[model samples]
Target: MRINRLIYHEGKVTNPYSVAPTSHFFGSTSQSDPLFWFVYACGPLPHTRGYLLFGSTLLSGWPVSTVHRKEASRFVPSSVRFFSFHYLSSASSFLHPLKMEFKKPATVLNLANIRQALVRMEDTVVFSFIERSQFYESPSVYAPNKYKIPNFSGSFLDWLLLQNEKTHSLVRRYESPDETPFFPDQLEESFLPSLNYPPVLADYADEVNVNDEIRTVYIEKIVPQIAAKRGDQDENIGSTACADVDCLQALSRRVHFGKFVAEAKFQNEMAHYTNLIRNKDIKGIEEAITDSAVEAKILERLIAKGHAYGTDPTLRYSQNPQSKVQPEAIAKIYKEVVIPLTKKVEVEYLLRRLGDDDEAEAQDPQRKTQLMNRLLSNSLW
Candidate 1:
């Protein structure tokens, strides 16, 4: 049967007549909120007549109205079925094409897929480090209030990042689950249509950002080790800052990919992670998730990549190939910083696995049940 019409029922507990025109959009944030409905068409439908169908945004191929659930039930033909709110969002996938297909079971959510993604990101980080090594350690870029631009009081790099975030936000870059902006507070809504990427991580996954710490480590540790020399260059301040942004964004994404890793691990062994989370055993959770052997492999792989990509094949210095950034320094970075931060993210994400929402959803019985159901549905998506 071809279903054409789609009427949304707000399902409010109040009298339908009392529904004065208030907000046009109804996006409920909590599970305990009154359930909504999507009344799909079966056959010929009655006219909306606009009787108490107030405060609703218009829907195409269907009446632009919100009816009481009981009133909505009157049009419930054999084809109509109840779906969770998450399903309502998922259904939007049909209208607005999925931009980031990270929700599928066989695609983005698994450990194997995540590992491949992480490996690719390593290449970006290595290349970025090599690029940054072209410039001297431009201390002016990181110094406070180094470039005095109107209405902004921060480092040159900070100002650049803010402008970059604002520009990217216009095209909806931050809407993608994998992206997290350093200047989150200043980001504006996209001029483009909303792309409802099917949920892959927790609702609060964005909050698990470690960009601040990443920037700190990059300046304090990574730059000093990877830069060409100790002197600051006046000519390369902008170029150096630009390269820093690239490295920071890459590192941020690589580290935060741990969220998906954590989610996949938690789903595979729910009971094990659940008990660990419940016990507040941070050490226990860390040990269970840690694979020292895997870490060693990553370090070895990164050193090899640095040697390959950081050096010119045709060139040699002495008996050894001349490299842009020292291969050992690259290995040392993963061993000291990237791996540890990733583990921190995994542990934090796992610890919040049992929470009601990301911040606090445990005490609410209904929210907990809904959370479990949502996680299962997302895993099966």
Candidate 2:
């Protein structure tokens, strides 16, 4: 991966050899004395500890005029020492195609290695001692209190007594601490917010139980506000029709089953959707149409708020096919409004169904009881 660039004197001199005989040879010789300069960049090195030498110097007749004494004399007078001569004499000659080698020192763990070995040795010693003690055959070695018994029932009773003794000994060795005092004075009061709401009484509220009234109020007041906040936060999440109904149906089934779905399953669904879009499937196109409509609506809202258009030159044109509005027409309507309207309608219908289900569950206790019973039966059987 090394690249080398060579630069030399730019000007050219006429060669007396190629020119007419009238030209002076001395003038042409100036061109032959061109100084060659080279710049080299060697790509990433393994150890970054080596020295570089010019490989060209190893070639035969290199420093070309050095072999010719007459030509060399022109550059270097007889009194002057030739540096090239000294360099060639001292150069180490090696075999062609030198094989480069790198040596890395073997790694050794210090005190940690010794500590680990010692710990393992201690464990082995403890295990061996336990194993050796277990081999003792005399019953008196384990328990000296057992009385001599000859009858079959007496032997059974002796064995049971030995087991009970072992159990009691082990239990006495390891026991939990005494229970903490239960008095309020001994307890530290936590400053954390209380989850329980206080009772609210009214003439109309009297018909409903206090707990039920509180819960109903929470659902009516808190739940809708939470839902609205979530919807606002997720406003930018582009809505598109599910590319694979079968996959979506599978996901819906898993949601209904309350089973854990792996990340791979979700990624597979995303990949499937991407492939469908790449293949220009009708469903994918429909999804794109729906998303485009949503994007247009968002853009319209931004424009109505006196927001400046984005700086991107490509976005100067509305993405709609029917949009013929000029770039300067800031209050222009999107051309393909019908598709988004249709998608909005479809989404609104689904939302309404969900809302109706919530309302039905809240109003009808019988329905709730039946649903709970069905879920319980499904789980059990």
Candidate 3:
């Protein structure tokens, strides 16, 4: 049988023999003769018969088929069946659609870039801390049931953070390798599209979650130290909680980014790290990598950053202008906690990196070679 001529008007398909309306083309009407409405995007010429395989089941309008008028009705049934069979055969083939894959940039997380991130984070941390400090360490904020969040305990900060992460975790926040959530269990499944982040970091990047440690340090040490002089009344609980959470997230980002630094360092000096790691020399590893001068400089920078951010520049010739924010305390936090924790992460990652390299070599020689090549090419080492 041949489909001689076909015409499309609105939702109707008319060939030389018969007119097929939308009602007849759809539902139970077409069930008995389902192949009757094969609609191809391209005009059906005799040569490109293969194109007809992609035809839709829906009734579509074409100007008209080219076949002769007398033989149209006789050819329609066989032509439709052939089209259906072609479609099924093409669909079952092993050939797949081309998928786009994004590789993470290898040079994205060197020491310079990581330090720049730290510098940027300083502004965020200071601004957030300043905003939270407006509430002046209100005791009621830490009181239970202050904020009614489901399946939560502890302070208003905790509840607020819990709910915020629950929503944001489904978006871009959780997927970012740099962010570590305070409440992992509270995070909802990500409803957002995948960003296809590059896995330039070591495998140990997934193993660490410093959120709990950060939260504890902030609450027990950083807050009291900063707010030691804050003697104010309980006011503006909501703003305070929000600011607190923002500061917490900023801090988390800063601390967790240690993974990137560690990755960069290990990639650069794999041999040096391998020697220390093989010998199980944690102290030697620390000594080899740690620059006391650099650490001292970082502490000084923090102190300077605190003073610059905390003090009002507008006040001219002010006598003994007491700053609410403590610069020395910030310096101390970095000097003691933040710097040490980052180095600790470096050591931890190096320890695991040796094993990961060995495993990769054992399992996939090509992959190990590629990784070795990447490490060798990195001039930053």
Candidate 4:
């Protein structure tokens, strides 16, 4: 296999016949002319390590180094295969579209990826909470107001949520299987084209939305984690309402992250989950996801994030003179509300594992009882 010699001059590639005019190489990143790209394939001596000679001068930027077989394939584009025989000969097996298909690397939904997302989310949650902490408690935001607007009622938060529905409706953030808005019924239909959220986990959508449970627990249990410190001041209705909306949205995202965790766990231990679901064993499901070791690490990470974000040296002499957010409180929330609720969601979702088509088996009380008894007898629990 042979390709026309590529004459490189003044950072542009030209053919020997001068039939094709000089053109910049696609994605040529170097600033200067005579840029050197370590020749992987596409030259007289393909296997030997050498620089692509640009008019008898060895280009400065390209380093002469041994190229791995795997990396050599990446240097040439499929579109230019006929033009470069060196790449064509090596990658000829890939020429037949029917024989083999090229695809982007798969994004495996696993614990490591989920944990990385959770780590990034910690920053979002902590920062949102910090912003919200500046305002004092205003219970009025959750209550019905006597004054009513054209299409809005309830407190200030209501109007704000309505405004979001009107403006961001086009973006369709709610359509994302990952996102669960606090005001689901109130959300306007999205006008924009829908985009898939982690199409790889499409099956997990039925289990992902634990927003209602998260909102309930957050308002009842997790609010004290931050509100207790910030709520001591006199109420500022506007600020408080804004803060409440921000806090709830951020908190919801953090808690619902359990879906990712659950998906990862299920993928890792499919057999274990299948057995538990078959036996209708809730306790087994809980135990499978519960790892005291991992939970401890998560709690410590959240606490550190809180301290890092909460304490500002410039505010040391302020009248408050205290961290608006407490590390211990953050740690406690994860230990008690966040993790427990997440595990609960996983168990609940697993309980309904049999889809609508399996209604008969899923709904049969007698079948469930027998399975439970059989599992108990076997000491599988």
Query: Can you give the TM-score per candidate against the true fold?
Result: 0.68, 0.13, 0.64, 0.60
Per-residue C-alpha lDDT of model 4 across residues 265-354, encoded as one tens digit per residue: 654565677678888888888888888987888888888788767878787667764666787887787788777876776676666655
lDDT of 3: 0.60
Tens-digit per-residue lDDT, 279-336, candidate 3: 8999998887688887787778877878778778765247764555677877787777
TM-score of 1: 0.68
- Compare candidates 2 and 3 on TM-score and give the better one: 3
Model 4, CA-based lDDT: 0.54
Q: What local lDDT does model 1 show for residue 240?
A: 95
Instruction: List, residue by residue over 55-147, the lDDT tens digit for candidate 2.
Output: 111111112111122222332334332333333222211101111110100000111222233233323322222222222222221132343
TM-score, model 2 to reference:
0.13
Candidates arranged by TM-score, highest first: 1, 3, 4, 2
Error of 3 at 136 (Å): 2.2
lDDT of each: 0.70, 0.25, 0.60, 0.54
Best by lDDT: 1
Pairs of residues at least 3 apart in sequence or in different chains that clash in candidate 1 = 356-361, 356-362, 357-361
